[model samples]
Target: MVCDALDLDNEEAEEEMYKLTRSFVNPHRNFEIPTTNQVFKMETGKNDVSLFPGQIVTVQIMPEVIQVSKKAIPVHIPISSPIRIILHPMFHQMTYSKAVQYLKDKSNGSYVVKPTPKGFGYIAITYIVEKDKAGVSVGLRLEVEGCKYIYSDLGELIVQYVEPKARRAEDLMAHAKFKSSVENLNSLEMNPNHSSYGFCFDYEMP
Candidate 1:
């Protein structure tokens, strides 16, 4: 008798789920997962200095062996994340150490525009915009490679340090829109589209 009751309860639960998902069962819709980029307000310089078109930057994560190389210079980065490669047309391809040395030369050792890694497929690309005895700060972009469509890693370049801030009404509205969209998707039992224009319940039952 107890087993029969449990089976009935399970069936009821599944029926409730199907009813909840009825509105989202669209054959043409595809669900999109949220990328990490949505978590941060990405910032950068007005005149960016990243690689030019058709150029690829090399990122290095395990920086131990690189320490012994003459081309590599140790940069005191406060962030312990995945390294990235930011390049220019002038620098098509280079080793991780080489990229660090290149930046060290440009900044006169004051800053380091180097890439760090956050393994698990996330990258920490940074441009060292400020340096001092107090602390070193860098503008960063976090994302995995080849997934720019799913997640665009907007590397930061500079930010305001000392200033009284006011919450802008426009910013608040934009944030509210994101929250509303998320809630709508969840309530509808649907996934958002890649373009964020639609939602779908595309899961298959085993």
Candidate 2:
């Protein structure tokens, strides 16, 4: 029975589109910046990237430890698997490619980085808009997959200086801003004014 169910489930998920995320608030509202961490320690004694919970970022799969043992034949293996790290890369136009290079370089030329057969790769590459507002970078932030390059600024999840304690009002406003981003993504998928990707975020509304 289990094997039969597995086959049926696979058949059901064969379709390209996910089951049209169903939610009353809208799918975009649910988009949260996935939890993230800094890829490397920086001079400032902090990790570089920042990601909110739920946002998605692609982390390359590379062989971390390559050991040449005393044995006649030394074997090397990767510590991690191909996965999208729930973090951000430094923003760059060719950030996707750079990311691939990072893995290639880090792995000492063990793996070749390329796009997965699935249209969407291990990582989801969605447009992240960070704008200057009142002397701060404020805009939509999420960890998604798609780029095959290493992002320098635009795409990477960067770590900024921690802000001093915000006043009650500031904190409230900050929370609202994040909520808005989620709402907007949900809205775009639902409305999808421009159908560039050949898929409409719209759903059959009852």
Instruction: Name the 10 consecutive residues with the lowest summed lDDT in model 1.
Output: 1-10
Clashes of 2: 45
Best by lDDT: 1
Number of backbone-clashing residue pairs for each candidate, in the order shown? 10, 45
CA displacement after TM-score superposition, residue 42 of candidate 2 (Å): 95
Regions more than 4 Å wrong, model 1: 1-95, 108-120, 126-206
Off by over 4 Å in 2: 1-89, 107-139, 143-206
Candidate 2 residue-wise lDDT, 26-77, digit = tens: 5464332222331211111122343322222222222235456776766797
Q: How well is each residue in 1-206 modelled by candidate 1, as lDDT tens digits?
A: 00011112333545543433332245443422223332212111222343332222111122122234468779897976443444633322333456555555443222322333323333232222222111122233332233342322232221222111112322433453333344564654354443344332222310
